[model samples]
Target: MSAEIIETLRSGRLANLGLLSDDDIQFAEATIKKIVNNGSETIRLVFPDQHGIFRGKTLSVHHLVSVAANGIGFPSSLLLKDTSHRTVFPIWQKQKDAPDYILEGALDVIACPDFRTCVDFNWASNSTLLICDLYQRNGAKIDFSSRQILKNATTSLQLAGYKALFGLEVEFQIFRIIDDALKHDQSQMPPTAIKTENITQGWQYLTETRYGEVEEILEELRQASETMNLGLISTEIEMGPSQFEFTFGVDEALTQADKFLLFRTMVKEICRRRQMHATFMAKPIMPNSAANGWHIHQSIIDLNSGLNAFMASTDLTETSVSSNWIAGLLHCARDCCLLTTPTVNGYKRYQPNQLAPTNVNWGYDNRGVMLRALIFDGDPNCRVENRVAESAANPYFAFASQIMSGLFGLENTLVLQPATINPYDVEATLLPRTLGEAISTFHNSAINRQFFGDDFVDYLTIIKKAEWDRYNSRVSQWEQDEYFNNF
Candidate 1:
């Protein structure tokens, strides 16, 4: 539209930076033009932070070319922040084990947009959206980025001539916003949660009336998801107040991660416009609210034959590939628990007979176990569903942990134990019951040290430990109720 912008685009600054492939440069130019012509005013350049929250800057349409040529600058410390927005790393200290990155004083980092992830947001002021990848100002890839970490984990599988497929069975809650927390005192680190009331009295799970009660809002979300190409398979009423479930069609880990984050953002945006609130918190603080779980259904495909690699082998003497995968998942369940259930509140979901697995064992079609092995003979849809992850877990990191664990099993030729009939009562190890336990297990895990480098493992443990420390410092109402009267 502008002569200056056109000249900048033709200069090939993006190509010169080695940020995009030749094909991506062409696509990026086209996408820029398309966004301008499509009447979008602004494009939000977003990158997922350490907590899986999108954090980035917005650029006017006129600056697209210039910004694309050189990435938008953001604080490198954004990636180092805990959920409370405090930079947990001791950047100010020069101790021997201090992190290698220059993170002090919230220094600058660059976010390079990925043209392939561009999506038109017809709902948000008719704007375009593109997710970015984090890079240092000097152009080095940021190792702590959740997306990059996941990509690194998948490289081993990709080189081994296999591709992973992941399906989503995530649950969340929606409430009508009674208070938006706009008052000055409400604003704080992490902010006070808005006051909300449930849209439906949701005791009858999957009943027709339960769905019909909130069908209008649900349809709006479904249609918005379709527009963004998020692959929404179905929506169902979950078994708690204002709780719901969304199942997505299977796709590769990267695509699924992008789709899920976008979907979560879309739901919040849409609900906000309608004076409602949507939360993916593992367990929202409400009376009798059921916790949400993110059940990841994973399977591998043979790159040569394009067949499901998890299918049970017909041979009697040889253990099935599915069994080995199960064994690996169980072995690493404790180590990876921090990734799958990151929040202090998330571990509350691990209870027996709640359709959330409490123990590290596999079972056939049983929802009570951590890994549910579903291998129908001759059925190509066979896969294992890991029920250990909470809905609030970062999708990229969660999937990466799974892929890494399964690869460990396949590489080591580990043998699977017999499937469990009594998932809770069995002698198998129980999942970490608290955030503190999860962090300790993850920090001491050899598998984590091997799969994710020591730097990353330490980085993650430090941030999570910060969160746990904050939790421990606060005295809850339960503590007051139990101690004050007795003391």
Candidate 2:
């Protein structure tokens, strides 16, 4: 391991560390030494991919120092892939067409470990964990690195003397594992009985009996979160069968994203050990069931003044900076849809009267609106809740997109439309109905390109277009059933 990792491990105060750099590897080595003392010699060097899946290699403690110094190697092509793991970029084709250029085709990439994320492996017998960032051969950050995008966005905000504080309320489904192979079949996996039992029994809100039913599972998650030093606020049974909602305390935007990713992984692993499966897919089981969403609550605090910019007034009113912020979120709701609800399945949740917003509108204490203002007159902690993102969304990209959009609104002093008493009947525009439409809007937005950079936007468009193309080619059951019988 590097000297920094060694020093980090020796400190034993891992939880309080900030963003990790190459110098922190000494601290990590000290941490590893402590783990070894406890008799666990295995460590997983994991990194989040484009789809937010954790991918990495597990190394022995004996090799930690060497791996930390040199970094672990992964394929460069991983960054050029879509959600389905298809290489969307035409790197090979371009190289083949131009033989004079030096294109090694499949080059090796490195994942530099982030030692500050070092946490004890709750599920492993004797192991610790770390997250990494992918780096190109020339030591340049990959264009599609979600974590890097968020870091860049934070840097912009910090430069303006403001800080982004984020809190997440994410919903997901948990199913009992009946059979390994059969469970892989999406149709038979959710088990309708699970939903019927939980929904039909009138478990609309959190109650003692409902909590008792899943006490053991919830307990395990709570313990695991505490062990990992995750700032977990609360977790409650959701509306759907085996569905649950987890909330986290407000933190810096990037740190909150990391915590969210780790917490989701922990819940899935713990559920699996108990013969259960947890899915973060936006609309896993369609129709008849309420869709799951990841609601993001955000605010901007003045770094110099130490005041929340989104809060106004000593009493609830019609005018405030908070109201203007809500206006900004609603104004860019259509353009922001691509980042918030990026997947095709995500659009299915925007149905009328489903508690999910279908149009770009704001309302006070209205969950049916895309932007809900949560100011209680003089509450300093008041902020805006954006209820558009799907659970599968990359938090970094999603949060960064929102920050840029809202910042634009704030800078322009945009006037928001009047609050709608009935969001469904309001005259506001609706969000993009499909991923294709959302991508089109995103690609056409000059402002978005200006904020996120032309190269990054172009790369994202190409990759996501490939995903849409792949999805379009596959014939769905609806098409087969409808056409096969009629035609």
Candidate 3:
């Protein structure tokens, strides 16, 4: 009966749609055998949603044999949630010519498992986790899937005979939990913020003394990452209080995106167990708080020649490909700001002389520039670092924005503006100073529609618009302090 069920799933819509390849089938069988032999009682079937948050069902070990091939069915409404976890789309009040699956009465969207992404759940005893990509019931790919967006972007790059690799520098803060904030009044659609105090009074960057203070927690996090194979290269103390940064090894864009999401989830789980809170929020609203940034180190390879495409042939400093890629990033920086930053709080981190870029520009090994070129004489590691993204940005979307924008430059053979010695003072376009400005810029861009399909552009726009509206409608603490006393 078990064998029959497994075969039945392997022969289902996935096979018909040509998604269940021979390799995929073999991988699933291997996973089942490993799970059964290891006595794993539960399996976490998960996929990153629109915001790249891990969400899925946990199933029994007995069902793994079948589910390994069949996958989990998640409500389509899961894809429509904003950052608040509130379903932003009007599913019940569906409009004419709306999306066919998501927001259409919350129909089932299949979470197709990629067995290659299986990892041992070290935090949970005898549990395993597998990541997935979303698909419609008819086996068509979900246009709005965060994973699929990166997949599509990568696929496009491949079609042009180039492949992209990315490395991630992730920064976040960990604090001692003062209050769980679970009282009646604190409960809402989005729960109230929990109170936390800095564990380290950190103004010292990468000081050994400071590292010794939190070595235990950092080691615990490091071990968890190692067990899950998250490609963690190093963990170091960042410039601010209780702020830490984890840098990972380079890999293909899509694989890195998966690891990035899992790493974020793992950090939170490990921290919360110790009565601590971990936040990737770009700028935490606290005294003397330093902002977190996600600096993406990216490079492309020419598949035909099997060489680094950005390598300068004779030009001592930079190549045409790298220049065009930089220009593409700068050109689309305004339009794709919503994808990179994605939050009202994110914009607050872009300040002059703060190890963050405030304007659209690139410079050679310059920390302040938006794009920092790291090219050396005939080194295989010639790459560009994009520093504009917040640590909280969705990895898939941010990487997609880079790939799509870089491709735009390569295809058009655009030239970059001269590398700025003084990035902040250079004649360059400033990044959107507010989320509202970003939304308007993205909404007006024809390029956004050209890259992400019309469906996704519209879907994301509505979701972001809802978030912006929520942020604007609220009478903030500033409003109360500034006007209440005077008025």
Q: Using TM-score as the measure, which candidate wins?
A: 3
TM-score of each: 0.96, 0.87, 0.96
Q: How high is the CA lDDT of each candidate model?
A: 0.85, 0.74, 0.87
Model 3 TM-score on a 0 to 1 scale: 0.96
- Model 3, 381-428: lDDT tens digits are 999999999988889999999999999988998777888888788467
Cα lDDT of model 2 by residue, 1-487, tens digit: 3445555443422222322443564465666566667676788888877667777788888877656566778876766677777776666656332221212475777677777788788464577888887766556676557888888888887886689899999998777766565343444422232221232232456776777878888888888888888888898878866678888889998788888888888888887787787878888663445578999999889888789976645232344556556666777777767888888889988888878988888788799988877877567898888888899888878988888877777666677777777878746688899999999998888877778886667767777888888779879999999999898
Screening candidate 3 with a backbone cut-off below 3 angstroms (N, C-alpha, C), the clashing residue pairs are none
Q: Using lDDT as the measure, what is the rank order of every candidate, best first?
A: 3, 1, 2
Candidate 1: residue 481 Cα off by (Å): 1.2
Candidate 1 lDDT over 143-179, as tens digits, reads: 7688899899778888877889999998999999998
lDDT of 2: 0.74
Clashes of each: 0, 23, 0
